[model samples]
Target: MPSKNGTKDSMLEVFVYAAQDYGYSIDITLNVHGSLVTGKIVGEQEYFQRLSENFKDDSSETAEKIKDELLKASEDAKKSDNNNVEFIHLKNAQVYVGDTQPTPSENHFLWRGKIDDVNGFFLGRIKQKN
Candidate 1:
């Protein structure tokens, strides 16, 4: 018998493919705190740059849009089944430009707070390690 969480897994796979198609690689980290599950997805800078150049938009805007789509995919997966198992919620979605070093660059973008909030937080040229 298939696991009840199959639907969620399938949905996540779809998101991963979609992200890859958009020239982004998604790294997901899952953390469980009590009854809540938090998932964080980070898209590397190369992908962000490619997406921005392809879409002819600001890198910040492009990153935000990507994060939004990821959050929506996660939410949809959460609601995919009515089972009582824990569902993952997006805790942080971000796009980083340049290598994951402790050096500041003009290409770090992030979206925090609730997933429903369409606004993205731009941490201008901040040092990010991984």
Candidate 2:
């Protein structure tokens, strides 16, 4: 599933990195409303840890807090003054296989093509990683 803000087929590219404990670093581009939003997942391990703590204690409050934090993170990723780039951090991601079915386990590790949000559509040069 794309981020709350991504539009269909608007996503152009993505990058991902392994984060700790069922988490990952994800980047995506999509058109949200009318703007292009580029975002990256940050500090995924920390986010999952918080969620783990909450689940361990069965703390509804903590879960709610986690949700709020995720939304904030998404918003933070979408924030851009120039209206071109956005960044997002996603944790505890539920990855799927080939758009067929949800992966067997939420904790199962995989690199995901995801969209956490979108703004407008823009084409920009991507520098190759050295």
Candidate 3:
């Protein structure tokens, strides 16, 4: 939930903070505005690792640059400690509208969203059959 008593849900904030600091994740489905976003919450380092893997074996300068930048961002996130969780990161993220099924054009991907934007959430994500 966005806010419980004028402040964001402490438990949810703790969840995100733990994921960022401990490299652990939990599958969750969230209601953001009207969209249904479902995914496995992951740490910044794990996110970068998965992303770098996707860009691996590309000899292009652009690919290397992207990987390096992501690595740096991951490191920076780890070092910073504001004690306030601002963003939520997810892997194998799927966003749905209504009852539509997944298509090749709409594949699961990494997602990052503002914690304050979430309205409500559940413990587990909706399993996509793609």
Candidate 4:
């Protein structure tokens, strides 16, 4: 989903903070899929390793929470018309948040879901009077 009223930036900040906590970096990419807005978040190998370690102790509850948070942010962006202009004709789009350190080089996705009503996620800012 795109960001509206700086919400996208805010969400990125959250991801950056979380990634830093685990000593990893986050890579985000936005793409246009027909009239839909698609997004991908890639967390590197070290991050995945740490996440796996945590999952062993907590059954991936933390990872689930993070995924939920990201999904929620996407949903919120959709609701607020904060998506990219190319998505103007689409009602929703899919987002993938994954780790690159998949075993056997497959099954790398940590979270995958749809964000609805993405057409509204890219409202432009209005100029203010001085």
Scored by Cα lDDT, where does model 1 land?
0.35
Q: How accurate is candidate 4 locally (lDDT)?
A: 0.34
RMSD of each: 14.2, 14.7, 3.1, 17.1
The alpha-carbon deviation from the true structure for residue 107 of candidate 2, after best TM-score superposition, in angstroms, is 13
Question: How close to the true structure is residue 120 of candidate 1, measured as C-alpha lDDT?
Answer: 27
Worst 10 residues of 4 by lDDT: 85-94
Query: Candidate 4's residue-wise lDDT over 13-128, tens digit each?
Result: 34433432333333333332433223233223223333344344454677777655555544454344222321111111234334222222322334321322222333221121
Q: Where's the lowest-lDDT run of ten residues in candidate 3?
A: 1-10
Q: lDDT per residue, candidate 2, 35-105, as tens digits?
A: 33333444433543344444455558877677667566534533422222233334333333333443334
lDDT on C-alpha atoms for all candidate structures: 0.35, 0.38, 0.78, 0.34
Candidate 3 per-residue lDDT, tens place, 1-130, comes to 2234554666777678778888779999888898888889997767777777767889799999998888887777778765666788898898877788632236678888888788889989887664
> Residue 47: error of model 3 in Å?
1.7
The Cα error of candidate 2 at residue 129, in Å, is 35
Please report the candidate that would top TM-score against the real structure.
3
After superposition, the stretches of candidate 1 with alpha carbons farther than 4 Å from their true spots are 1-59, 82-130
Ranking by TM-score: 3, 2, 1, 4
lDDT score of residue 73 within candidate 2: 53
Looking at candidate 3, what is the lDDT of residue 95? 86
